[model samples]
Target chain A: MTRILMKGNEAIAEAAIRAGAIYYFAYPITPQNEVGEYMARRLPEVGGVFVQAESEVAVGNMLFGAVASGKRVFTSSSSPGISLMQEAISYMAGARLPVVLINIMRGGPGLGGILPSQADYFQSTKGGGHGDYRVLVLAPSTLQEAVDLTMLAFHLADKYCNPTMVLADGMIGQMMEPVEFPENYVEEPVPPKDWATTGCQGRAPIIIKSLALDPVVLEKNNLVLAEKYKLMKRDEIRFEAYKINPKNRILVVSYGTMARICQTVIDELEQENISVGLLRPITLFPFPAKEILAEAIKPNIESVLTVEMSMGQMVEDVEWAVKDKKPVEFYGRTGGIVPTPEEVKDYIMKILAKETPAVKSWNG
Target chain B: MLTSFPSFDKRVIIFAGAYGSGKTEVAVNYAIGLATSQSQSVSIIDLDIVNPYFRSREAAFELEAQGVHVIMPHNEMCHADLPIILPEIRGEIERSDGKVIVDVGGDDVGARVLSSMVDAFAPKGYEFLIVLNARRPFTSDVAGSLKMMRDIEISSRLKFTGIVSNTHLIGETTTETVTEGYELAVEVGRAAEIPVAFVSVVTEVAQQLDPNVVKVPVFALSRQMLKPWEEKVKAVRGL
Candidate 1:
C-alpha cells in the first residue's frame, strides 16, 4: 500500500468512501469544513451522495432517513453543529440505524473559536441527547489512526446496531501527515439490514421509533440496551499503553491529539529520570476503565494525571477507574487551546514537585 | 526540456491547479529564487480561497524578512471562510515595475476568482501556468489533467501559457516517481498545446536523480508548509 500525505478531515472523508459509505450529508463548519468540501467533490466521483444541507439540523435528519433506508451514511461537523445534530443522533440511536459521524471538535459552549479542542468528550461519551442510549466513540490521535478508526466506525456501528462517533479535534483535522489506506477494503459482509424500511414486501410492516407509552415495555428496551453496553465494555474496549513499567510512578492518561502531546511529555520526563507511562484510550465510550485500573494498581504508581484539551471531562472516568485508590490529577486547557508539549512538561514537573519538593530541581 | 525558465518578461504570473499540486510551494520558491538570483523586485500574492491548509501567506513573514513582498489577507480575515481579494490587487496589477506572481486557489471554483482579475492582467500580458502534480487524484492521468486545464481556463477566462509538473509524494518522492510525472506532464502539455514549464523537486531529491533522465527545467524546493505535528510524527514514524 502506498502512503500519501493527507489532512485528518479529508482523509476521514475519503476513508468513509472506501468503507462503503453511500451517502454523506453535512453542513460545513470549521474546522471540519474540509470534510464536507472534500466529500462534495469526491462523493460524486464514487457514485455517492454529498449534500451541503441548509443546516446541521436538516442534515442530521437526512442522515437518519438515509441510514434508516439501509444505506451507509455519515456526516462531519464541529462542536456547535454536533450540538444541533443531537436530536437526530438520538433518533438514529433509538431506531438502531447504523450511521457514522465525525466530530472534529473545536472550542465551545456556543460559537467558540475555530481551533483544536476535546471539549466534546462528555458530549460524545455521556450521550448528548435525552435518551437511554450510547454512541460508540472512537478517538484517533494520529492521521493514520484517524483513517483506520473512521473505517472501523462503519463496521462497528453496523455490528452493534448503533451510531459510532469518530471523535477528533481541529489540530487533528488541520494537521497534515502521511497515511496508507487499506488496499483490500472489502465493503461486503456488512451488517444484515433486517430492520430496514425497504417497503413491506413479504411480511408485517415494522416501525422504528424511540417512544414507548407503556412503562413496562420501555424498561425492557432500556435493559436490552444496557446489556449491549455491557457487551461493548467486555469485548470492544480499545486502548494503547505506552512504555508501561512496573516502576513507573506517574501515569499520564489522555486521548485524541492531547495524548500525542502526552507521549512527548513521557519521553521528556523519562530523560529527567521520571518514570511516567502514557495510557491512551482509543475507544472513549468503553472508557478503557479496565486498562486504567490495571495500570493504576501497579506498585510504585503514586499518581495519575489526566491531560485533556477540555476542562477535564475524561478525568472523571479516570477517577471512576481509580476509585480514590490513587490520586488522579486533572490538567486541561479549554476553549480550543491545545497545550504544547513544553507546557504539558511544565505541568508534569509541577505535579512531580508537589509529590516530592526536591523534584523541582530536576527541571534544569 | 527547457533547463532555464524564460526571463521575467511578463509582469504578472499566476499559478493554478488541483489543491495538492504544490502551487504554494512553487510560488514561494519562485519568489525567493527571483529575489535572490535576479535583479527583479518580486511580490507574491496569496489569493487561494479554496483549501486553507497550504496557503502562501503562511510564509509571508519569512518571505518579507528576506526583502520579498508578500501580500495576503490581514487581521481576522486570515481565517475568514469566504474569499476576500484585497483592493490593493488592482494597484499591484497597475503598478508593475517588477514581477508579481499570484498563487490562485485550486479547481474551477478558485479560478472563478481569478476570472474577475483577468482584465487588469490582460493589458500587462500575464502568464498563467497550470501546475500539475500527478499524485493528486484529479490530475493523475492525461485525461484528468486536460479536463482540469480546460475547466480552469473556462472559469478563469484566460489561456494557460505553460504547465508545471510538480509531482511529489511528500517525503516519499523518488527520482523515478518524478520522472514518471514528467512523462505524464509531457503528454498533458502536448494535449493542451502548451510548453511544459520547469519541473520542481526538493533539492535533496534532485541530488539523487541523474539530471539527464528528467531532461526538464528543475526548480529545487524547500519544504515550507510544515505543520505543528509533522516534525515529531516524522521522527517517530521515520518517514
Candidate 2:
C-alpha cells in the first residue's frame, strides 16, 4: 500500500473503485465535484461505467438501473441537488437496492451559500428521503476514514441489501490529507445475481422496485427493514473515544469535521488542566449511543456537550444516550461556519462551571 | 470605472451571476486577489447547481492545493437530490478567521436559495455581492441588469452590498468590452442605489488598459480556458 496525498473526495472515489464499485452516476455539485471528476476519468480507465446524467433525477434512476443489474454503484451531490434525488433515494431504499451515496454537504435550506456546512446532520442520520427506512450513514472526519468508510459502506450495503451514505461535509471533501491506499486491491466477488433485475433466463424474472400494492407484503417488507436496522444498531455501531480517562469530567460529542475540531479542543483543554474527552460517532445512523452511554456512566463526568455545525440537531441523540446520568449541553455554529478550538473549549468550560455539586467529583 | 467598497467584518463574500456570464472566472480571480493581497486563508464554495461545465466546483482540488477551502455538495448527494444543508459550512463562517468566497449558480432561481439563511447571516454581518456581466442575456442592458438584481435581492432576502461588472466574451473579450460593461454597471448602480464596486478585465487586456479609465476598482480575471496561455506566459516572464 502506498501513502498518497488525497482530497477527501478523491479518497472516497478511489476507495470505492478498489472496493469493486463498477458503476457511478452523478451530477455536478460543489465541494464534492472532485469525486465525480475523479471517477469520470478513473472509472473509464478501470473499465467501469461513469455517467454524468442529465440531472440528479436521471442520475439517481441511473443508479437504480446499474444497482439492479447486480453491479456496485454510487453517486454524489450537495444540499439542494440532493433534494432533487430524494425521490429516487426513497425508491432505492424501498427496493432494497445496495448503493453507496456520498453527500459532500454545503450550507442550505435552498441553494444556500456554497460554504462548507454540516446542516445535513439531521437529514443524513435521520433519513433524508421519505418512507419508513434508514440508510446506513457513515461520517468520516479524516481523508483516511473517508476512504475506509466508503469502502466499508459498499460492503455494508450489500450485506444488508440497503442503501448507505457517506455523510461528509465540504471541509472533508476539499481537505487534502495523506491516506494509505488499501493493500491488495482485489475485487470482491459479486454476490450471486439471485435478486437482480438482469433478465432471468428460463425462470421467473425478478423485479427490483419499491412499489408494493399488497398490504400484507408491504407490512412484511417494512418489518424486515426494521429488523435489519435493529441488527445494524447492534453490530455496526462505531465511534472513536479520545482522552476518555475516568477522571475526565466533560464529554464532547461530534462527528465528521466537527469531531476533528473537538479533538483540537480536547487537546487544548488538557493543557489547561481541564479534563475533557471526545466521543466521535463514525456512523451517524445506528449512532454510537451505547458507547456514549457507557462513558456517561462515569460518576466523575460532570456534563456532556454535543457540538455540531448545525444548531443542536444531533443533541437530541446525545441527550438520549446520556439518559439523565448527566446534564447535556448544546453549542454550535451553523450556516457554513466553523467554531474555533478556543470557542469549543470556552463552551465546555461554561458547561462545566454550571454543573451541580452532585455532578462534580474528583476521581483524579 | 472602479470603486472599492468598504470591507465588512464578515469573511465570506458570495459572487452570484447569471449563466454564461463568466461569473466563475471573475470569482476565481477575485478569490486569488483576496488571498494574495491579504496573505490570508480564502475559500471558494461552488454553489453552481446548474450548468455542470466550467463550474467552480470543478476547481476544488486546485483551490484546495492553493489553501482555499472549496465547499460544494458531494457527487452522491447530487444523485439523491434532496435538500441537504451541510451545517459544517455554517461552522466555518462562524470561525471569523479567513475570507470565504461563494460562487453561486446562474439565474435568480439559483440565487433564490439564499433566502433561507438570511436569519443565519444577519447577525454575522455577511455581505452578498451580485456580479453583473453586461454581455449575458437578461443583463445585456442597464434595465435588464436592474431586474436581475431586484429578482436576486427578492430571492436571497439580502440587499446587494455592491456590484462587480465583469463583462467579457469567451476569447474575443477586450478592454473596450470591459469598459462598456463597467459603464453599464455604473448606470445600474445609480438605478439600484448601489455602488459599482469593481470592473473585471482579462489579464492580457488589463496590462494594456490605463488603470484610470474607470472610477472603480479593476480586477484581472484569468480564464480557465486560457490556463495554458497564462502558464506559458508565467514561464516566459519568470513570474
Candidate 3:
C-alpha cells in the first residue's frame, strides 16, 4: 500500500469513508473543520452524501435519521459544538442506534480557546447528555492510531448497537503525519439489521424509538442498554503498557496526546537510571481499570500519578482503580495549555525526592 | 562550499502554499536569516486566519529575541481563533522599511486574506513565492501542486514569481527526501514558467545532501515552530 502524508482530521474522514460510512452531516467547528472540508470534496466521488447542517443540534438529528435507516453515518465536531449535540446523542443511545461520532476536543466549559485539551474526559467516558447511557469512547495518541480507531468505531457501534466516539485533542486534528490504508481492504460484513425502520411494504411495521411510556418497558430497555455496556467493558478494553516492571517506582497513567509526551518522559528518565512505567489507555469508556490496578499494586511501585491536559478529570478513575492502596496523585495543565515533557519529568522528580504529599503518606 | 540564498532586493516577501506545506517555518527562517545576515530592520507579519495552531506568531518570542519585529494581534486577541487582521499590516507594507516577510495561511481560503492587501503590495514590489511540499496529500504530484498554485494565485490576486521546494516528514527527513522534493519542484517550476528558487533542507539533512544534483541555492532550516513536547521528543527519539 502507498503511504500518504495527511493531517489527522483528513485521515479520520477518509478512514470512515473506506469503512463504508457513506453519509456525513456536520456543522463547521475548529480544530476539526478539515474533516468537513475534506468530506465535502471527496464524498461525492464515492457516491456518498455530505450535508452542512444548520447547527450542531441539527447535525446530530440528521445523523440520527440517517443511521436509523441501517446505513453507516458519522460526524465530527469540537468541544462547544459537541455539547449542542448531546441531546441527540442521548436520544440515539436510548433508541439503540449505531452511529459514529468524533470529538476533536478543544478547551472547555463554554467557547474556550481552540487549543488541544482533554477536559471532555468526563463528558466522553461518563454520560454527557442524560440518563444511565454510555458512549463507547476510543482515544488515540497518533495519527495512525486515529485512523485505525475511526474505522473500528463503526464496527463496534454496529456490533453493540450503541453510539461510539473517537476522543482526540486538537493537536491530533491539526498535526501532519504519514499514514497508510490497506489497499482494496474490504470491511467485515455486518448482518442486516432487522430492527431498522426501513418500511412496512409487505411485513409488519418496525418502530425504532426511545419513548417507553410504560414503566416496565422503560426498565427493560434500560437493562438492555446496561447489558451492552457491560459487554463492552468485558471485551473491548484496550491499553498500552510501556517499560512496566517490578523495579519501577512511579506509574504514570495518561491517554491521548498527553500519553505521547509521557512516553518521552519515561524514556528520558530511563537514561538517567530512573525507571518509570507508563499506562496509556486507548479505550476511555471501557477504561483499563483492572490493568491499572494491577500495575499500581506492585510491591516496588511508590505512587500512581495521572497526568492530563485538563485539571484532573481522569485522575478520578485512576484513584478509583488504585483503591487508595497507593497514593494517587494528579498533575495537569488546563485551558488549552499542554503539559510538556520537562514539566512532567520535574513533577516525577519531586515525587522521587519525597517532597510532595505522596512521600509524606509513604513515610507515614 | 554549499550555496546560500542571495540577499533579496525586494523589500516585501510573501510565502503562501497548501496547508502543512512548511510556509510558516520557511517564513520564520527567512525573517531571522535576513535580520542576522545584514545590519537592517526586519519584520514578520503573521496573516494566518485559517489555522489556530503553529502560526508564525507562535514563534514571536524567539523571532523578537533574534531582533526581528513580529506583527500580530494585541494581548487579549492574540490567541483568539477569530480572524482579526491588523490594520498596521498595510502601514508596515507601505512604509518601505528594511525588510518585510509575510507568512500567509494555507490554501486558497487562507490566501484570501492577501486579497485585502492588494493595494498595499502593488506599490511596494513584493516577491511572492509558493512553498511546495511533495509530502502533503493535496500537492503530492505535479498536477495537484499546479492546481493549488493556480487556486492560491486566483484567491490572493498576486502572481508567484518563484517556487520553494520544501518537503520533509518533519523529524524523519532524509537527504533522499529532500532530493525527491527538489525533482518534483523542478517539474512544477517548468510547467508554471517560474524559477525554482531554492530547496529547504533541515540542517542535519542538508549537511549530508550532495550539492552537485541541486544547482539552486540551498537553505538550511532549523525547526522553530515546535509543539511543547517536541523538544524532549526529539531528544528521546534521537531525531
Candidate 4:
C-alpha cells in the first residue's frame, strides 16, 4: 500500500468514491470546497453523476433523488451550507436513506467567517435537522481518520439504513497529511432492495418520504427509528483512550479537531509530572458514553474536563458520562476561535491541583 | 386596487444580493419598508461575509432606532474561520412574530453560509430571495446569471423564493439600465422557475417610466437614507 500526502477534504472525497458513491452533487463552499472540486474532476472519470446543484437545497434534494434510485451518493458543504441541507438530511434519516454528508465546518452565525470552528457539535450529534431521528456522525481528528471514517460511514449508513455525517473542521479539511488507502477496499454488498424506491415491480408502490400525516403511522415510524438507533448504540460505539492506567487521575475528553489539541495538552501535562489521560470520541452520535463511565469507575481517576471550541455544548455529554462519580469541568473558546495547547495545559494543571492530592504533595 | 404581500406566520426573509449591487442600501431601506408596511416586529440579521465595507452592520444604529432588531455576528463571537452556529437566532425562527431579514453576503461563495441553518429553517418556513444586479460580473447576461443562481442554490441548500431585479451603477444607472436588467431577469426567472418579485428603480427615474415596464411590481429606492415610513412611501408611490 503506497502512502500519499493528501488534504483531509481530498482524502474523504477519494474515500467516498472508492466506497462506491457513484453520484456526487455539491456547491463549492470554502474549507471543504476542494472536496466538491476533487469529485467534480474524478466522478466524471469513474462514470459517475456530478452536478453542482442550484443551491444547497437543490444539492441535498438531488442527493435524495440519487439515493432514492438505490445508488450510493454524497454531498459536501461547510457549516452554513450544511445547515441548509438539514431539511433533506432529516428526510433522509426518516426515509432511511444511506446518504453520506461531509460537513467541513467554518465560522458562522450569519456568514461568521470562513475559519475552523467546532460550534456545530450540537447540530451534528443531536440532529441538526428537526426530527425525532439521529444520523450516524463520525468525527475525524486526523486525515487518516477522515478517510477511514468516511469509508465506514457508507457501510454503516447502508447497514442501518440511515444517513451518516463526516463532521470535520476547516483545519482538518485544509491541512495536508499522510494517508494510506485501505488495501482491500471493502465493497459493500448491495443490500436487499425491499426498502428502496427503485420501483414496485409487482409489489406495493414504495413511498420514500419522511412525512406521516397520520399520528399512528408516524408513531410506528418513530419506534422503528428508535429500535434502529438502539441497535446502532450497541454496534457502533467507537473511541480512542490514550494513556489510560490504573494510576491516572485526570480524564480529558474531546473530539474532532479538539481531540487532536487535547493530545498536545496531555503530552505537556505528562512532562509536568501529572498523570493526565484522554478519551477521544471518533463517533459523536453513538458517543463513547459507556467508555467514559467505565474509566470514571476506576478509583484513581479524579475528574474529567471537556475542552471544545464552542461555549460548552459537548460538555453536557461529559457530565452525563461521569455523572456524580467525579467533578466534571469544562473549558472552551467559541465563535471561530481556538485555544492554544499552552492554555489547555493551564486548565489541566488547575484541575489537577484542585482534585489530585499527589499534585498538592508535589507542590508542597 | 389592493396589493397582497407574501406573509408568513413566522418566516425570515433574507435579502441577499451580489456585491456592488447596493445590497446594504437596499437591505437597510427594505427592512424599514417591511417594518412600517405591517404592524409587526422585523429583525435584520447582517450576515455579510464578503467585502468588509458597506455592510448591513453600518446601518445597525439606524435600523435599531427604527425598532427593527439588528442581529450581527460581531455582537457575540465574530471569527472568520470558526463555525459559530447562532443558537440565539433559533429563538427568532421559533418566534411567531414579524419577519427576520437575513442580509447575507454577496456571490455564491459569500452566500454559501445559509447552508448551515438548513436544519433550523426547513422545519419552519423560510423564504430566501436572491437580489440580482444584471450589470454585475457573472450576472451581466442571462446565461451567466443562471449559473450564479445554480451555484448559490447548491451552496445555500435553500430554494430561492423569487428574484429582486436591482440593476444600478451607483449614480450612473438610468431607466434604460433598469429596464434591460428587468428583461434579463425574466429569462433568468423562467429558467430558475421563480418569479421576479420586484424590480427596483431609483425614485427619479421610477417617477418618469410607465410602471408596466417592469412585469413585476416596482419598488422605489432612494440614494439618501431616510426613515422606514419614508422608504415605504417611496416603494408604494412607485407602485
Candidate 5:
C-alpha cells in the first residue's frame, strides 16, 4: 500500500471504514469535525450509513440502537460533546453492546477552548458515565498509531462485548503525518454474537437490558461486568518503553501526544549525557501499571515524572503504579497549553538536582 | 541564495487550498522570504476562518521579527473559531503601498470569505494561486484537484491565476513526492488553463531535488507550522 499524508481524525475514520464499521453517528465539534466530515463523504460510497444527529445526546443513543442490531458502528466527538453522550455511553456499557468512540479531546471543564488537551484522561479512563462499568480506552500518540488503535478498538470492543474508546487530544486530530493503511487486510472472523437482538422467527425473542430491577440480579450483573473488565486487563494491556536502560536515572511517564513530547525530551537530555527514559501508555484503562512499576523499581531509576497537557490527572495513576518505591513527580500545563520539551527538560533537571542531596543522605 | 525561485510579483497575492494542502505554510514562508530578501514592506493577512490549528497567524512573532507585518483577528477573539473578519483585512487588501499576501482558509467553505471581499480584489487584480498537495485525499489526482480549483473559484468568486504545487508528507517528504505533486499540478493546470506557478518543498528536500526533473521555479519552505514538540528543537536552536 502507498503511504499518504493524513490528518489524525481523517485517518481514524478511514481505519474504521476499512475495519468494516458500516455505521457512524456523530455531531460536529472542532478538532474532530474532520472525522465526521470524512465519514459523511466516504461512508456512502461503501454502502455504509452516516447520520448527523441533532446533538451528541442523540448520536450516542443512535450508536446504542445501531450496535444492538449487531452491525459495526462508531462515533467521534470532542470533550464537551463526549460529556453530553455519557448517559448513552453508560447505557451501552450496561447492555454490553460493542461500539467504538473516538474522543479527540479539547480543553474542557465546561465548553472549553478548541486547542489540544489531554484533560479528558480522567473522564475517559475513570468512566465519564456513572455506573459500575468501564470503556476500553486506547490513547494514540501519532496519526499512524491512531489508525492502528482505531482498528484494534473495533476488534477489542467486539471481543469483550463492551464499548471501547480512542482517547486522543486535539493535536492528534489536527496534525498531518504520513500513514499507510493495511493493504487489502482481512480481519479474523468473529463468532456471531449469540446474544444479539436479531430476528426471533424460530425461537424466543431476545432482550438485552441494563436495568436489573432486583438488587440481587443487579449485583450479579455488576459482577459479570467486573469479570469482563478483569479479562480485558489480563489480555489487553499495551504500552511502549523507550530508551529503557540501567543507565537511565529519570523515567518519564506520559501518554498520547504528550508521550511524543516526552520522547523529544528524552532525546534532548541524552545529548547532555543525562540519561532519561519514557514509558508511553497505549492502553489507558488497563494502563500498563505493572510495566511502570517494573521500571520504577530498577536500581538506577531515581525518580519518575508524569507530564501531561492537563493539570496532572494521569500523575495519580503513575503515582499509584510507582507506590512510592521511586519518588513520582508531576509537571503539567493545562487549558490546552502543551508543556514544551524545554520546560519538561528543565523540570527533569530540577529533579536531578534535588535528588542529588537526597541520594547522598540515603547513601551516607 | 538561489537565484531561480517563485517570485510573487503582483501587489496583492492570495493563496487558498484544500485542507492540509500546505497553503498556510507556503503563505507564511513567502511572506518571510519576501521580507528577508527584499527591502520592500511585506504584510501577511491571515484570513483563515475554517481551520483553528496551524494558521499563519501562529507565526506572528517570527514573521514580525523578520519585519513582515502579521494581520489577523483582534486579541480577545484571536483564537476563537467563529468567522470573525476584521475591518483591518479590508484596509490591508485595499492599501496600495506594500505587498499584501492573503492566506485564505481551506476548501469552498473557507473560500467563501474571499467572495465577501471580491470588490476589494477587483481593483487590485490579485494573483490567486491554488496551493495543491496531491497527497491530500481531495486533491490526490488531476481530476480531483481540478474539481477543487473549480469549487474554490466558484465559492470565492475569483479565478486562480496559478498553481503552487506543494506536496509533502512532513518529515517523510521525498523528491519523488514533490515531483509527483508537480506532475499532478501540471496536469490540473493544463486542464484548468492556468500556469503551474511554482513548486514548494521543505527546505531540506528542496536542496536535494534534481533540477533536471523540476523545470519550474522552486520555493524552499522553512516550515512555519509545527507541532508543540517539534517546535522545541527549533526554539532551542534560537531560529
Candidate 6:
C-alpha cells in the first residue's frame, strides 16, 4: 500500500514476521545483527518467538527443532557463523526438513572481514554440508528482491520439504533502500507439515532422521535427495538478463551484489556504445545455466566476463556452462573489497581491447 | 503568520541532528519543497557516512527526476558501509549559487566529516539546522536535545542557526503527538538559543491543528518513511 525506506536486515526480519515465521532462532553476527535485534524487540507484539541462541551451533539445532514441529522459522548469519552452523544445516538437509536460512555473506575462509562479499558462492551452491543434498539457494540483488525472495524461500522450503537459503551479500543486508512488503504476506495454504513430530497423539509416530548407519538406507536417502535437487533445478531456475541485444559483444555474468555492480557497468558503457549486457542469476543453486547459455551463444557475443566479489568461484560454472564455446573470463575482488563499477568497466574494456581472443580456440 | 515553506536566504543548508531524529526524511522533503518552489536550483549531498541504513541518497532518483541534482558516491559505494568521502562533494559545496542541501549523518561522529570542508565553507556561511524529533530515544527532554546539538556543533565546527521539529510515532502519529513534540521543540529552542525554523505536521494531522497554536510556521509533511505493509496495518487498524 505504501513504500518505506528500510535497511535490508530490518526489512527481512519484518518480512519474516509478515510471512508467519512464528519461530526465529539466531546468534548475532555483523552486517546482519539488526535482524536479530528487530526480531527480539518486535516478535512479541506479533505472537511470534525470538531466541538469541548462545552460539551459532545452538541456533542451527534450534532451527531444526522449530521446523520439526512444523513451524515457519529462519536464522540469519554471516560467513564465520554460517560455517559453525554447517553441521546442523547438513543434518537438516539430510533429514529433508524445511527451514529458511539467510546468509548475508562477508569475506571469509575464516573471520576475514565484515564488508560485503560474494566469496561464499561455492560453499552455498556446491553444498557446504556433507551429502548429495542441495539447499534451494536464492540470491537477491536489491532490498525489495531480498524481501520478495525471503517470502518465497519459506514457500519453497515448505513446498519441497527442503531447506532454502537466501544467499545475499553484506551489501544487501546493510544497504538502505525503499521497499514495500507484499500486502498481508502471510505464509498461506501451508503444505501439510503432516510429517511433524508433534507428540504422535492417537496417531502413528513420525520420525525424521539424517543418521542412517546402514549403507543401503544411506544410499537410498542420498538418491532421494538427488531427485529433489533435480526437480528443483528443473523448476526453480531463475535468472534475469539486462540489455542483451544483438549488438552487445560482451556478456557480463554475476549474481547478488556483484550483478548489481555489473548493471552499473552496463549503464555507463552503453553511453560509449561498448555494448555490454548483464546476465544475473537469481537462483544460485539452480545456477541459471540455461539462460546464461542462451544469451552467451548469441551471434554478436564476443566474450563472457564472470565477475564476482570473490576469487572467481562462479567463473568455473560459467566456463562449464559454455564448455569452451566462447572464452569465459574471470574478474574478481576478494578479501572484503567491493569492486567499483569503473573497475569492472575497465576490466571489461581491457578484455575487449585485446586484438584477438586471449586463449586459443577449440579448433580442429 | 507564514503559511508555506520558508524562504532560504542562505546558499547552503546543512541538516544535522541526533540519530533517529528524522533528519534524512526532513532533508528529502525540504529539498523537494525547495525544488518545487523555484526559488533556486537544488542539489543534495548525502554526507551521512555513519549510518548506512538511512540517507538522502536513497531518494536521489526521485529528486533527480524532478530536476533536483543528487550527488552521492557512485555505484556500490552508495550502498556500502565504507567511509567513502569523495572530492566531488567539495566541488558541489564550492558552488556559489543554488540551494545546496547537506544531509549530514547523526551525532558528532557523523558531523565530524564536515570538519574537512571547513576551509571551503567558512567564507560563504551556511544555514545549519538541527532537525529535532522529541519522540526519538534520548531526545525527549530539552537538555538532551541541546546536548546533542552541542556535540554535533563542536564536532562539525559550525553553529546551528535554526531547529525543525519533525517528530512522529509512525502510522499512529496524531496532532496531539505533533503538539507535544512542538512543546519540546519550543523548550529546546529557548534553551539552546536558536530560532524555531518550522514544525512539520503530517498533512492529515495538520488539517486538524490551529496554526495560531504553533509558535512558528508549520510545514505540512507528507510521510515518506512508511513501508507498504506498515501502511496496510495502519489502514486496517485505522492508525
Best by DockQ: 5
TM-score of decoy 5:
0.96
Better lDDT candidate (1, 6): 1
How large a fraction of the reference contact set does each model reproduce?
0.08, 0.00, 0.43, 0.05, 0.59, 0.03
> After best superposition, candidate 3 residue A326: deviation in angstroms?
0.8
Residue A60's C-alpha lDDT in candidate 3? 93
Chain A TM-score values, per prediction:
0.95, 0.94, 0.97, 0.94, 0.96, 0.96
Q: For candidate 5, lDDT tens digit of each residue in B168-187?
A: 98898988998998988888
Q: State which candidate, 1 or 4, has the greater TM-score.
A: 1
TM-score of each: 0.89, 0.61, 0.96, 0.60, 0.96, 0.68
* Candidate 1: segments with Cα more than 4 A from true spot: A42-47, A187-191, A246-250, A264-276, A299-302, A325-331, A334-337, A353-364, B1-7, B231-239
Each model's C-alpha lDDT?
0.83, 0.75, 0.89, 0.76, 0.88, 0.81
- Candidate 4 regions exceeding 4 Å error are A187-190, A199-204, A355-364, B1-239
Across A1-364, the per-residue lDDT of candidate 5 in tens digits comes to 7788998889999999998899999999998998988998899999999999999999999999899989899999999999999999999999999989999999978998888899898889888899989999999998999999999999988998899999999989989999999987777676678888789999999887788899999899889899999998998999998999989999888998889989988998888999999999999998899999999999999899888888778888888898879887888777777878888888898898884233211112
TM match of model 1 to true structure? 0.89
lDDT of 3 by residue, A64-110 (tens): 99999999999999999999999999999999999999999998879
Worst 10 residues of 4 chain B by lDDT: B230-239
Candidate whose lDDT is highest? 3
Candidate 3 CAPRI category: acceptable
List, for all models, the DockQ compared with the true complex: 0.22, 0.02, 0.43, 0.03, 0.55, 0.07
Rank by lDDT (best first): 3, 5, 1, 6, 4, 2
Better of 1 and 4 by DockQ: 1
Q: What docking tier does model 4 reach? A: incorrect
User: What is the descending DockQ order?
Assistant: 5, 3, 1, 6, 4, 2
User: Candidate 6 on A1-364: residue-level lDDT in tens?
Assistant: 6455466887888888877788999998777877887788688988988888999999999998889998888999999999888888899999989899999998787877777789888888888987777889999988889989998999999888888999998878876565678885555574688889989889999888789999999999889989988889898999888988999999989888778778877887898988988988899888888788888899888888988888878887888788778778888887666777767777888888874445422221
lDDT of 5 at A92: 93
lDDT of 3 at B130: 97
Which lDDT tens digits does candidate 1 get at residues A1-364? 7566676887998899989887999887878877887888888888987877999999999998888888889999999999999999998887778889999998887897776789898899999998889999999998899999999999989888888999998888977666888888875475578898889978889787777899998888778788878988998899999889997988989998888888877887788898899899999998899789889988788888888888778888888898878777877787655676777777778777874332211120
